[model samples]
Target: MAGGITDTGEPYSPYVGLVYMFNLIVGTGALTMPRAFATAGWVVSLALICFLACMSYMTTTFVIEAMAAANAHIRWKRRESERVINDSDSMSDYSDDEVIIRDRVDRSETRPILSVQPGVSPDHFDIVERVEMGQMASIFFNKVGVNMFYICIIVYLYGDLAIYAAAVPISLMEVACGNHSCSAGSSIKYNDTDSCWGPVKRKDAYRVFLTIFTLLLGPFTFFNAQKTKYLQIMTSLMRWIAFTMMIILALIRIGKGHGEGKPPVAELSGVPNLFGVCVYSFMCQHSLPSLVTPISDKKRMNGLVLADYVLILGFYSLLSFTAIFCFDNSLLKDMYTLNFTDNCDVIGVAFLRYFLGLFPVFTISTNFPIIAVTLRNNWKTLFYREGGTYPWVVDRVVFPLITLVPPIIVAFCTHDLEVLVGITGAYAGTGIQYIIPACLVYLSRKRLQPVFGEDMPNKHRSPFHHTFWVIFILAWAGSCLMFVTANIILTETKH
Candidate 1:
């Protein structure tokens, strides 16, 4: 169980693993961050983003350590099975419970004090297998806890898919509508009812683009998303290009002394949304097993992870600062790239303007299918039965349809990226990022203490290995949850 050899992907160097994590972290959430920061104010936004980044990194470490503990527990189970198989005279006669009781007593008594520190064997307990978060939940959590885990991740992935779904069409609609088309510069903000093509409204154009997006990328859900290897590379290149362009364009504007932005020192009213966006931006916890387990060498794994966090934090800061300072708070687009596309004063090159205008389409289109497939697989995992396979139709059709349709409907109803990202991140994002990892680490440590002994150490242990961190994370998640919920209620009441 410690051995993650079940995964078929080739092992890569830790540096490559770090890069993949970087790519994963700096995705859709980052695109919407400038607006969030602008609304939240630079001073408060900077402080909160920094705190969230550190908290996110801490939780990320907790997740890695939990994965190691999960693998260790599997190894223990296997060894226990082997012991029962070989020691038939002592184990065969009694019931399973009685056997466990006797086995624990006998093993504890015979084991040497120093050797009882943790492992049945240190080598055997390595985290070789890539146990996904869901798999780890099944292994360590009780029936209710496992069910809750699946529910949280499923909802988060659905929110992710919806954001990806809405973003592409919104980008396309902006480029298509006469009001926003990058063929010329316009500072005027248009309503959804504004004309796109003659009689068609911008909202209609959005729906049409959504349909095209669904048709173009939706079928990848029926197959393995890993087949998009080439596409992933292409989109990644485009991401760097877009980010660099945005940053450079912003810096150039700021340097010219034409910058219009003057964000307040602090704005408490905006903190709820800001918190959500920050939490969402830093979300890579769920996919850690895939990224971390593939590393060929992990001696400096923790350091590599820390460096990645620092770099990402700095990049996010640069991007947000340039954006908020380069454009006025009211003028900053929800998708920061749109600001360039919509303003000739900022970026006059027609080709670059079009690219910035439609960049979300390029990035989100490639990602939608992968996310859909992940959500589908999670659905399957939730309902999976022992020794039973899903029906052909259910596996191939039902799950994919369920995964694809909801998000499409969501995009149809609302193309507001800020609201979508904010609500999703504040709720489901909190679960996957903060609450779950803390619970996993706490439960995993407790689970291992009996078999491995209290003194046993997980080489993959996090810097925040103390019980207080776990409690603090839980408290943080609870507070964030309440804060967002209360904000929602108040906003709705005022409206």
Candidate 2:
């Protein structure tokens, strides 16, 4: 329902909404998950992933609730303005003596509706109006809060671009250079110095692919790129095919008792990376506003969201479990698709092998321009002032250039998908996914109570409506940041 629209201007069915959310939540993050699972151990990874999924789902509800509240506030203001204008017009027609009487009557009639009182349901939490997260932040947050929200989103998007930029090339490098023969087995690790084409090192091959990727897809950022509905469908189809192939192949291998994995029950050292991976994988908060706004019916929205999360949780669990059990923990590639490429025992066909290996290249390449544009637009939004405009050069050239350059530079410098995802998801992602939603909902409730009164039935209020949940989410986010920061510092020190 978010992007899909009928010719008749009708919103999509709830089932379609379910599918969109599923596609969004399951992306490149899922590919990195198997390696994280292998490192963190099956049992620990399972527990942590479940916990993180629940947390993400909780914050998702918060965002939906805030959306509903924001819509209600918009509706209330429009109605109030209409009433005021009608009253003012009617008063103008009356004489001086009669004006006093009419004004008193008007005040008496409108007082009950405006004032906080029992049984006054002024704000109905129906998401008819589409208020984006940024608008909601501006409406509900103070100046500092709004700035923090923008910063978090900008950082997350940059991270997303970097991940996409790196993923495509990394996949290409692995596919182009690595042997297609199955002789390497699950235990062998490919190094950066390995030959890709003739004397071209794999690392150099990655850079070459990165440059080509930028050249081909980067220019779209300079222009307005739109009407990507078909592209989205194609990418979604490819993603499902690629993911299903890996899962089924892993299952087939494990069923035959040929799994090389012997992952530990718990690996403390791997928990930080695993935490980052899970956080990144579960991210759908930034896009939730678009996803939730166009639903034709939202009575079952909560249930639909819950079902989606449950299914994703099960899917992630199934994929990661099968992967950790099928491949040796030491040999699991950062990009899981690479695991299927050279292993003839699992995938005998060379064409499908190359397809699976280059799957990220195919899917993520399509997404890079779109994300780059989004980042560029956000840059404009962040610096935009009311009743003012940017110079043509700054508007067209500078913004897109800034958005496109840094992530490419990051990708050029390092192709570590895992670390990129981890750092991005752990820091900026935590703020976007957890802290922002919690604050938005909490602030929305606070802002709306005086206008709508305490008894106004909000249809989309989160089950975790207590103050403690907000505190808990924020606390969890803070603790995760500290943990990840400490891990990074210590790892660098050791290196």
Candidate 3:
């Protein structure tokens, strides 16, 4: 809500809650969804979209409900503490208002508004006692053996860098979609000519560098756990405009005679695999806590949270299905726009190029702050201390280093969007974001004791509910495994 306590002893705003939902959908996922459909068929793409949408909805519901339970417990503990203090003469010397004022001033001076670290006193901590069944669903889609979700979360940490990293293909889309194809020699078959090889040439090196520069937005994570800021919101909105542009382009393509071919399938064809991939990526349900830091209605669940997931899947499905009808799998251009015109109008190309270029720039810029905050929070978790000047400094150094290292390797190693997406999806995108959370939730749930503590009976008390969660864990776990294997095969073949 408007004034909820966090681990860092600061209060957060309500709007940031929506940012989490929007950011997940509006970034790189939007850009490449068409490409995904080009490989998988239209019907498969539609199915994947439905699957992801359902998972996303259930996950968001789970997270919010669990958060509600946790906050309630924290409130109850504070009440108990207040009651004890009123009965006891131990702190009779200080007035209640004075103590509260002191705490408020101390927090305002010392903590970042977005910080989620709990206060030293358990009474001040907002504890999420029992994770809900819906929340458990969030973890289910993601917990695979090894996949892109891990890489996405580990590297991007819900920051601008992730967005930028995801947007890299958008920049290339303009060039790829142009009438001019980049064949090693004009006679090469599309599959025979590897996209990764182009960046090695001196001419394309600049483009690669530019894309990586966008990816470097990884350092911004430092501020994520701190507080709400206008700049962050505005930046996110700018990229969202790019998403709207893509949607417009899709509409335009449909209006034109573009969607008539063998339902332009994504050049890749692992439709069944989408169940796993989406389960891993969409398992982003656990991320809801990081969002809860900002809202005014701490107890009231935000309907928008689930709506964001629905909207994302809806967007993905639209693009994917459309692409399927537009081009054949092998003929499907990596960017999806190339199949449209040989004598394409200048205005259409210009619009596509301009927005495509801007999407990556904004995405990378936003990723930086998200990574900084995630690293800071993870560090606190490891060190067991409030993130202060020293911790912040450490995060500053580590965040950029981590961000810079991968892209540099990526730059020198390859520039093929397909290879990059495959590797990214297989490694970063799959693991941290989806698979790990799934495993953790499954393990954690199994580890829970049946009896709820005396302090809160409505919360974690019943062992009876564990049966449902156990089933969910198995369902998601099986799905994640399928996704991991499919990702490996698709990536290997595509590479």
Candidate 4:
């Protein structure tokens, strides 16, 4: 799911598409980016994030082009089947006016296919039907490849569920135990074993909240979430308000000469986590179909993508710069919202502080069920067999249990959001963000030559049409995986 929400598939304008993309790209991942930015230093963070934003945008276009190619593949399959059936009936050739422009064909395969007919544009590969990543994988990838795609995506979704599972309880624990006085500095923090209620430690309080949170939101995993429109609306509104309030308050504090932070220019030790956070933050490729397919006009889609990325980069820079400067670096919380909850000097009103504390609680709670259901559905799809159905208990109970249990258990083991987001994004996120798209687009282009000839131009072909871009993405993904693994090993050895 994109930013923990999927598109509704209703026809919408390009501008509307832009807003949805914006929402999809900015989620819990963005909330954690500031701390990573502060850790890695502003200078390194800014430069790397910009380069990543560009790379993410390029792969996003690759996904779009691959979607069109997937459509083409499906179309070719239907045509092949029709050709078989028609051969038995009469020698009638199937002809249509929807001809595509082709440059050249193989010497032996000079058939007017699509034979350069006039007055018809290249409408063969337009993304009308919504072929999701899984379906596209099936169409384009081998059996092993399909399973690999499912595995990568399923792992990423599990990571998402675990992050959310920990985030809400962590928020509740903070608000419940944090100091409420007019604290002058944002440096005040707490350890997990610190007392919250009498005899009840903060870690225990977190588990209590976690249990309550699971009981409340866990049921939605078994069924579809059709009635969350209003909840989503409220969540979206509150999310924007909370983010805006945090940014503004940080700016106000800095302006009042109370800014206590002085982040270093660069820190190489933090770069691995920063890479993961940024990769995670810009993760919308998996849900591109849900967002891009609904747009009524797609001619200007590349422009929309460019503009959206620009805006997001600016938003990330402003939010992170303000926070890193306004608060001491060591006191910054993994969940950035936790930083403002008890900072009475920054948010003087008690009620506002509580709201900020619980802001993630409300918004993330809405997203949890949605993501859990998505993961559950993916589980079903991965184990699914042709013409076979699961028994009632298995369908209703087993799938959901498998989906919900691992992440909750992982959360129980550790609530370190940085580590969770870092590991998830670096490995699985690399696969989803870079490797899969690169492979899909490359294979899709190769698949096209057999059916439509080599010179056929997909109207939605990416500007980076050379094989070099795809090779570059694959190489980068491989290098990233190795580097992150080595970094983790070295860090652990040191610890």
Q: What is the lDDT for 174 in model 4? A: 91
Residue-wise C-alpha lDDT for candidate 3, range 382-421, written one tens digit per residue: 3333454555555566644654455545544444444444
Q: lDDT per residue, candidate 1, 1-495, as tens digits?
A: 112235727899999988899999999899899999989889999999999999999999999998888888887778778776788876777899998998789777866323443335475346688888877887778999988998998899889988998898888877776343445554557788988789998999889988988898999999877636788788889999999999998899899998988988898888999898899999999889888887888778789999999999999999999998888888777787778776887887778888988888877877777778888988887888779999999999999999999988998899888888998999999999999899999999888887767756678888898899999999999998998999989989999
Q: Judged by TM-score, which candidate is best?
A: 2
The estimated TM-scores of all candidates read: 0.92, 0.94, 0.62, 0.93
> Residue 32, candidate 3: how far off, in angstroms?
1.3
RMSD of 4: 5.0
lDDT of 2 by residue, 308-372 (tens): 99999999999999988898888889999998887887888889999999899888877787888
**Comparing 1 and 3 on lDDT, the stronger one:** 1
lDDT of 2: 0.86
- Computed on alpha carbons, the lDDT of every model, listed in order, comes to 0.85, 0.86, 0.47, 0.87
* Candidate 2 Cα misplacement greater than 4 A, ranges: 1-10, 95-123, 183-187
Ranking by TM-score: 2, 4, 1, 3
Summed backbone clashes in each candidate are: 5, 0, 78, 1
